[model samples]
Structures are given as structure tokens and as C-alpha cells.
Target: MLAVAATWSRLAAMEFDHVIIGGGSAGCVLAARLSEDPHVSVCLIEAGGGGDDIFIRAPALIPAMISGRPRINNYAFLTTPQPGLNGRRGFQPRGRALGGSSAINAMLYVRGHPRDYDEWADLGAEGWSWADVRPWFLQLEGNGRGGDDWHGGGGPVQISDQSAPRRISRAFVEACAEAQIPRNDDFNGPEQAGAGLFQVKQFRQGQRKGERCSAAAAYLFPALGRANLTVLTRTRAERVLIEAGRAAGVLVRRNGRRRKIAARGEVILSGGAFNSPQMLLLSGIGPEDELAAHGIAPVHVLPGVGQNLQDHLNYTILHRSRRRDVVGLNPRGLVRLGRAAGKWRKTGEGLFATPYAEAGAFVHSRPGLDRPDLQLHFVIGIEDDHMRRLHLADGYSCHVCALRPQSRGSVGLVSRNPADPPRIDPAFLSHPEDLATLMRGARIMERVLGAQALAPWRGGRLYPHDGSDAALAADIRARADSIYHPVGTCRMGRDEMAVVDPQLRVRGLQGLRVVDASVMPRVIGGNTGAPAMMIGERAAAMIAGAGGDGGAKAIP
Candidate 1:
């Protein structure tokens, strides 16, 4: 209950040209891009501790950074009851550090689908079509694939092929070929409708600890020397300060003490999808009735501030192998462990480098489908989606995800308290079209497993088939959920409910804007990380009044 304005005088000095809140993926990009000006002072505030851990930096060491595992690096936020999932409270694990989820995620670099952004432009987010966003994606990626019209060559983030491939990994790609699905050299390439290798964030040295080039390591670390940028770690933003009509500052807390940061140019909330809207609601910028119920007066009644929440719903299928498969334990983990240690100690090789999924593809459930409706990730371990954990059995698993569902959900405040988790109702299966598409994807998976080549290798179903369309549909509806990509809250549009305009500015507020996944009008057809970074990269150019070059050269 501290007064936000009362604490401003006791805190650190005056205004910054830009105050970027939540130094995660988008915030780090903004800080890096804007500070290139060397004139406009920028202040970046992150609630979590420094993202400086060896385990997080290593691409392979990422899975080891688990939450609720005592020393894991993440914030465990429980969701309000989800009415759609039989009143279940979902576990939303968000990173609490500089690079954000990019530091702790699986590091799979996916650009999603071109049509995904086309939907954005179609929804009145002008200049957000596939053509407009394609350049931004190219600007940030330094893939080993070399410079293409589609991808950049010498960008900060290194998108390269994984160092080592699991034995079964190569077979998965062959399996796709046997099933009539083509093999693609790149998922981010012109055609995204085939199975191939997925590009990852990796260094030439391979899975070395503390060397994973995350956004902070890639963009912000190099930009930190700029005198115009100030990075404040462990500072949690409580709410945005919208005085009269413009967003002037933010109410923040550090070391159990409160403070305020007033922004002269803009208070940009790059807190991503979950937090951007959550922060907005806490600052009395949401639906009229919701704000009034919390005893806070709404400054601008933006009904769509926390609406249009969307995420990919996926179900994994696991099968036992006929031979010493990817999941097949050598019966002596001690021997395998000894060999892996030997390899790493000698040639700097072994299982420590990669964990399958070295190859996969996005495919249509059937021919003539406009886009690839299913995305498959072939893991070496037996991962059961329904249980949300690895299986006890020794077998490899395949995660067949429904790329785009017709379902729509929402993320909104359950109470006035910012600490309280929001109610996330991603009403899956509520839409008939979503159910049909997912079922179709499931059938496609069945076809892949039923392929003649895989017939000899296929074992008993780990997720047993119910056989009935009604029953299979029920299993999918109950189990399939997010691939950790949640977006579109505080969606951008021209409608009355739109929270942000085409320029990513707040509809009714000045000096405040959101440049993150929260501005997506709909969930993209693929993973959202690449596109979210592009938004930050492109938005930086617009805000700086410079053309779309981040070359760090002097402005003409």
C-alpha cells in the first residue's frame, strides 16, 4: 500500500529517455537497439536476479535448469482455475531474469509461419504482414546457413545446427520421408512444410557452460558499456504510472524498498505476453467493470487489454523401441555415464551436446491443407504430454502439435493484487474447428507410425489409443495444451477493444507502448520467440526515427 509518487524523491536520480520494463526477450532487444543511439538514455529494469549461470548458457544444459527443483532458475506462478480444463490450475513457469525465457528455454529457433504475421496485418496491425516482418527476422539471426534473403548472416544471435545428433534423430527424418513428407534443410526456409533439422542457439565450442549467447549475452551485454543505458537488476515493476492521460513512469521495488522511474520519452513495457497485460491491469488500464471491481478507476477503458489470449495445444505420443533405441537404457547408466564423461573429457563430445529432435518437420494432416497443421518434435526420451513429465519407461517419444487451433482464450486478473496469478482460460476444444484440426493432426501421426518402414520399429503405444473418434477426440481435448507459447493479450487492432495501435502505442495513452508478444493479434502458427524478437528489433527502428538499420553507424 505504498504511495507510488511518494517514493520517487528517495530513489535514484532523474528521467531517462526510455524506460524499458522487464528486461526479458523484447526488453533486452530494445535496450540494445535504442542504446546504439548513444544519446537517448535508456533504463532497463528486471525483477529477477542476473541471468548468469553456466547451466543456462549451455544449450544442452538448459533442461537442467528446472523450476521447483530447489536451485532452478524460474518463477513458479500458479494460474487461477481454468474452467475449460475441468477446473484445473495450470502451471505457468516464466523466467525471472535478463534474457528471460531465452536463457532458460530449449533454445529451438523457430520463426513461426508467414501467415501468422499476415493475420496480424489482416487484423489492422499494418506493416505487420509476412513481407514487413521478414526483414526483421533476417536482421537478428546469424544462422550458419549463411546470408539468405530470408535470414541474416552476421547477427547477434547465432542460429546454428546442433553439434551432435542422437542416433534415432536421423531416423525420424527418414521416417517423415517414408511417410511421404519431404525433408527440409531448414524449418525457417521458404517452405516450412517438411521435416528436417531444426536450427538452435549454439556456439562453435558446443555445449560449454556460461557461453550460451542469449539476448542479454548477444545484445545487451555488448551494449552495457553505453553511458546512456542503465541496467537495474532485481528491480520488480509493480505498476505503470499513467498520469492524466500519458504513461509517465513506473512504480518499482528493489531490495524490499520502493522507487519510481519517470520516463521522458516513453515507458515501454517489453514484459512479454503474460506480464505486459498483467502490469497494465495493475495500473488501472483494463476493462471498465474489472477495474471498478478492484476499486481502481479506469483511465482508459480498454476492454481488449487482456483479451484474445492464444496458445498452441499439443499432445505427445510415445512408443517402445524394438532395439537399443534412443530411450533404451544401456541397462547400465553407469557405463553410459562413464563413456559420456570419457568423450567429454577427451574429444569434447557425447550426449551432453544434444537431446534428439535434431530433425523434424511441420506437415499438413492431409494434402491441400493451406498450411502445415501439425508440428512434430522427436525427443529421445519418453515424454508424456498428459502427465507433463518424462515417462518411467525406456522409450523415445514424439510430440505432434496442432499448429493452429481455431480455439481462443484469454488472460485476465483474478483480483486487484499484482502478486496474484491471472485467470487464464484458453478455452480449448470449445471451438468445433479446433477440435477437428487437432483430430486431423492426430490421425496424421497415426499414419506416420503406421508407415511400412516404421512398422518393424514401432512398439506398443505408450499413450494407448481409444480407437473411437469421440474417445480420441476426448483425450486430445483434455490433454493437448500450450507449447509454452502464449500470446495476443493486449492485442493490437483498430477496434475499440484494441490495446495498442499499429505503431504499437497504447490506444489512449501517450509515451507508453508495448512491443512484445502481447501485441500479437493472434498466436502465430509456430514458436513465438523469433517473431517476438523481430517486433522488438523493428519497433526500435520506428521509435529511434531511423531507417531499419541497426548497424551502429552514425546517423546521416
Candidate 2:
């Protein structure tokens, strides 16, 4: 295996010690960290192309990135009709290239609450409690505040506040304080509940010509100089090749051509939550009955392979200000765009900045809970007039989401072909508890909206404020959408629902690991980008024994 690795290193060709499935957040981090050792060959496969487009680099141009002709920034997918949402179909957007969702999502650098992973460790995913993962977070980040025991100074990923975009961002923080929520210094710090400007995964590309750097732009770019890394974009993994129930290789397709390659050591699936489980199910590793339906022999009848689907449920309150002044996205909105360009040219600081999701917080809706049951993610501007579809009028939206939902769904195969999208049912509002939390969440949204600070921006009731809990229950049923934080499916635990062990190895297959959000025992409390990136960092070190102290860090 070492000789082959050397041969491949010299030839700059196949046979990798680690084959990462997706070149998104997790895969990119793994590829960069693992390939640092030229002795080990690393292969990263991305179904999407490299993100060189200008829209991807700009923090404010995210929607335009997703709604373009090529749609190169995203892998657009539609879920099977969700029965819980009145059988309404939902849209699933996964990032296509180097940064994945980090490439397309509104750049919000939130690191959820510490209690989330602590609970995961308590639930069964050992060595994964907050204490174990926090170091990796600090390791990958070059925080704006510089290095502390909690953060690193010279990491590849650049994390800072939008330079000139701080005005509106500060306004967001002031409004949160005026509302009596008490400003919390850092969402990524000890406590998670409160409103403050969010940290962003942004960098000063240059005075004008630099591409706004992203995770892939940071982690993957530095590693590109290494000889051991071979990154193939637009090459999608068809299935994991299992030889006698042990992982051996993978089948991938590019430009209508199919090819096979062997993994001398391990085949790691970092395809996030949705595609990871879908690929596993397509490879005959899901429930026995589902595999039989597709006429494929079951490799392992893991009933939970695609089960336990969950995501943050969001409620948007749309308001039309009486001042006739557009908060965002109007003819006068060119000011925002103008600022982005001017700052991009002058100081690498402006609206091109990441004020997209500047202020946010976590809170327990009804109170008396052990932790915050809901998280508030407030954006000051209005991007799309409506939800999922185009808007009929001018308005700004404030979104509140139920953080830790009890509702569960599943992902399954639509057909035997891996090219086709798998059936995903996020099944939002499926449980009564989830419904109650979200309804209370709507009340919290109103409280924040009606605060004295918002008096200057207050308008008539925007979307729905008059509905009763029963009526709001129906309204929530009508329009509660996903903030796009999906997880579980390939859950990590010791129970039957667990598809991977605490070490993250596939239960029935040797040399195979699911090292992405798919293995999360449950979704974390905030945006998943940080947690997912941290997972990649830890997993790569574990696989290669390459980091500080070869021993796994213990959770506090």
C-alpha cells in the first residue's frame, strides 16, 4: 500500500489513503489536513465545480448565486412531499463545490451552544462532547480577536466582522439590547442566548482584486501546493464499493464515463446530512425493506440509515414599514450594493460584507427550560419578498426558529440510480411538542418586533400576528420552513438507530466511515457550518494520527 501510495504520489494519480466523498465543508478540511503529509495520497471528489464565480465570493450576493443560469454554486433538490406540512413539497439546497453551503449560504459564522455537544456525549457519541470538539474549532479558525485557549491565531479559515458593514450590524445589536434581551458578547462564548453582531467567515481579499475568501478558499487553497492532494471537481461518487462487507473502493462518474478506484486505507463520506445517507441507501446499506424495493441485495439492514431526519424549523414575520423607507431590496437598495463595491475597492470593507445575518441569539421560548429551546436569527434586510417563491410586494422579514426540535423524518431512495435525488422528508411540525415550541417562537418574534427600539422601523402586522395558538398552529403548518440545518439520518450512537460507532466507523462495514453531519446523533443548536468543519478536522486527525497528541481529546 505504501509503494502504491508512493507511485501515485510520483505519478500524481489514483489510489488514495483517504477518499473524501464531498468537497464541501468537511471534505475540504479533511483533504487539506490529511494531505499535509506528502507520504499519504489524498483524493477529494466533488460533484460540483470549483467556485471561481464572483457571486460566491461576495457575502451579499448569495441569493443571486443560487438563482443563476448554471446554478453552479448549488445542487438544487426537491424533497418528497412532506405529510406534516400538508403534503407540501420543500426545496433542498446543497452546496456544489469547494466550500459547499459555506459557498452559498448567508455567511453566518455561528458555533451553536456548548450544551449541544455535551448532550450528544451524554446521549452516546463519546469523545465528541463539547470539550473534545472545541479545540478543533479553535484550531481551524483565525478569529478576528486573535488566539486564545478558545481560538487560534494563524489558521487557514479567516473569521472576522464585516469591516464597514458594522454600522447596520451595530444597529442590529442595539435593537436586541433595547428590547431588554441583554447583549451577549459572543454567541460562540460561554452562554448562547442573546443578541449581538454575528461573526462571519470572511476575509479581506484585497483592496479590490482579491476574491472574498471562503473555507475552501482558505483550507483547501493552502493545501493545493502539497503534492499528495488530488482534487477532482464535477466528479460525483456513485456508490461505496464494498468487497465482502468491507469497504474497498468507490465508483464515480465524470462526463458520462464511469471509473473505479481503490482506497488503500479508508473511504470517508463527508457528503453532509442529505447526500451521505442517500448514497449509503443507494449502496444498499439502509433498511432491509427499502433495499428490497429497489431490487438491490441489502449489504446491511440498518433501519436507521436514513431515519431520524431533523432540521431547525423557521417562522418568518414579514412587515411593510409605514415610513416608506425600504429596509432592503428595493430601487433605493442600490446603496447596499454600492457600499459593497466601494468597500471592496477601497478598504475591502463594506456591504460586500457579511451583514446578511448580523444579529442573532438563542432563548427558551416558554422559560423554565434547562436550555434555550429556540434560537433567534434576525436579518435586517429583505432578500426575497416571499418564502421559496417570489414576493408579491415590498417587505422585510424577521425569522425565528425552534432550536432543538423533537420532530423526526427520514431520507430514502427514489430509484436505484445514484444520479437521482433521494426522497427526503424533513417532516417539520410532525410532533405536537415541535408545534408548541414553534408557536411560542412566533410569540418571541412578536416581542422582539414590537420592542421600543424597533419603533422607528415598526409597521403594521406583517405576516401573521393575530392568529391564536390553534390558528398559529395552522399558520406554522402553512409556512414553517427550514433554515437548511439538516442532520441525523446516519446517526452516531450505540443503539440500533446508530449507523456509525462513537469512533465514526460504519457499523457493518470495515474501513468505511461517515465523517459528516450525517453521523450527528442529533442536530446542534445553531448553524451547522462550524460544527461540520470541526468534525472534519477531528476525523482527519483520528484517521491519520496526525495532530497534537495522537490521543483523542476527552469531552468535559
Candidate achieving the largest TM-score: 2
- lDDT string, candidate 2, 135-159, tens digits: 8898888787888776777777777
lDDT of each: 0.73, 0.74
Per-residue lDDT of model 1, residues 208-302, tens digit only:
42145667776887777777878887777889898768778998887677767888888899887788888898898888877887787787778
Clashes of each: 0, 1
Candidate 2 TM-score, true structure as reference: 0.91
How many clashes in candidate 2?
1
Q: lDDT (0-100) at residue 314 of candidate 2?
A: 81
